[model samples]
Target: MNDREGGPSGLRQRTRRAVQAEIAATAMRLFLEHGFEATTMEQIASEIGISRRSLFRYFGTKEDIVLGDHAENGRTLKAALEARPADEPPWEALRAALKALVESLPYTPEDFLKITGMLHASPSLRGRQLEKRQQWTELLLPDIARRLGATANTMNELRARALVACALACSEAATETWVRSNGTVDMERAFDEAVAAVRA
Candidate 1:
């Protein structure tokens, strides 16, 4: 197990995080400008002033860099939900967390444009994104299952998966609405409408 307490291990972990952040930021910018498929892992590393081998050590694949944060975000959302007031409902907790998550994202307009374009135009990226979502669902469902006193069986798993999928769908719908409305509809508003649609 990794140690959270301060030590050499902690220091190394922090360094690793900084390196990953640097890599992701650079990769996203390049991917946005050049397109995902056109962007090479070597170019990403070169932009970060690192060797390709070192980049490989940090992220196994180009797709991994783009999709890696889903797992981290899932863990964070879980922890955030757990930390919320016990009286709060699960959906409410998730809603609040989602807003905070968007706020916490370091995405620039350029980054958003790239991701939105790629996700819309590229079937491969969409498929990869779905797989990443599935990975996130797998991480989050076990905790939710335990909370509901249900095992991680197919039915419970499907419910958990559905929750996340609906959330993403709602987010996407809201984004489309925002675009059509000339940015009058912010993502948070869209997310609210999306979640509400799901609840109803």
Candidate 2:
């Protein structure tokens, strides 16, 4: 809403995203404490000193809050991919991007585990997370398409999306393993293991 108000000015967009992340982080803590099914929009809204209707202005559903900032994180992830050396292979470059995402997020290991565990436990949450990954694939498409020696057009879109999807699945698998390990394993290394298993 705020982003739309000023026609997507950088400052307004960043300010709006900051508020969204704050709301999401606070709401996620509530989710961890009360459980996802038990937490309500009213409770999250009250905690943030906003009305339930106002909360909807930021996020459309309960699943969205706990899922975090997909668009913002997608941009962050794409930047990470873009920064990788041109000579690196696609999967290797994607690994770097995924690693960068983990490093850039505001979660401590305990907080991350709490949220991730909730994702594992809830069907709706897991579905939303998958949808977010799909969003990330679109954000990541053009650069990856270029890396594959293909232009990012209608003809090449499917090929590029497929490549990004595989990398995201590997990333997701690594994340699941990390949660199972109680966040003890290095994320990048976990991703490497998943990639290795897929190759094997």
Would you list the C-alpha lDDT of every candidate in the order shown? 0.73, 0.85
Off by over 4 Å in 2: 1-19, 150-159
Name the top TM-score candidate. 2
Give per-model TM-scores.
Answer: 0.72, 0.83
lDDT of 2 by residue, 1-200 (tens): 34465565767778878889889888887888899999999999999999999899899999877766767889999999999999888888998888888889888878878878889889998988888878898889888888888655776778778878988998888888888888888777878887888778
In candidate 1, what are the lDDT values of residues 81-173, reduced to their tens digit? 667666665566667766666666667664555566666566776677777666655665555555555666889777766775676677668
* Top-scoring candidate (lDDT): 2
Candidate 2 has a TM-score of 0.83
Query: What is the alpha-carbon lDDT of model 2 when measured against the actual structure?
Result: 0.85
Poorest stretch of ten by lDDT in candidate 2: 1-10
